[model samples]
Target: MSSLKFYNEEGAGQQNSDLYHYSQAVVLGDIVKCSGQGGWDPTGKLDANDVEGQVDLAFQNVNRVLQAAGLRGWEDVYSVRSYHVDMDASFEFVVDRFKKHCPDHRPIWTCIGVTRLGLPEMLIEIEVEAYAKKA
Candidate 1:
């Protein structure tokens, strides 16, 4: 088994010093499991509160992690989970974004509506699982 690697791109690991158990992505052999990413930028600031902006940022974060792992694109994604504070308002936006990004292949996805999330201003958080051929 290959060892795992982690990343804290937004400096969350440093800010929350006690949060040592989290990682942006973990590489286990040929698979990469990405943690849930919100609509925050590298500076840990909320970029947007609206559905489209939030979804776009969330996918951007995921893409960064996937690129770090040397994966091609969303084609390698096997599963995805999106948490939405307002499902009715955000569902269409999320679907459209997903279609735009991962048009060829459709991965397993789950969209959940929740009352709250880790951040009060965040409207969406996206998590993904991907696999690639061991090189």
Candidate 2:
């Protein structure tokens, strides 16, 4: 039986991963699940007041975590869950970023609206799940 594999990319995902006791991504067998990532930059500072920038950064963060595990790219992503502070206004940017990342194929997507996230200034967060033939 294969054991679980946890990946924590340096300066990726939430800065409080250690305090929260959660990894950036976990892999078991050929499935990889990543924690929700906000718009925080590599230095862990919130990228405030720019929803488009935040959306782009969030996608980058997700990809960074997936790459850390040496798994398939966005093409292998089976599902994605995106949380937005204001869906009415931010939805377009979200779709644009998603398409930019996974241009060839459209994966299952879920969008949610929330009043707040891990931080007060966080505008967007995204989580992804991918499957591969081999890890």
Model-by-model lDDT, in order?
Answer: 0.77, 0.84
C-alpha TM-scores of all predictions: 0.84, 0.91
Predicted structure 1: lDDT:
0.77
lDDT of 2 at 117: 94
* Pairs in steric clash, model 2: none
Model 1 clash tally, residue pairs: 0
Query: Which candidate number would show the highest lDDT if scored against the true structure?
Result: 2
**Residue lDDT tens for model 2, 72-101:** 567778899999998876899888887888
lDDT of 1 by residue, 26-98 (tens): 7777888888888766556674456778888788878876776677757789899999999998889889888
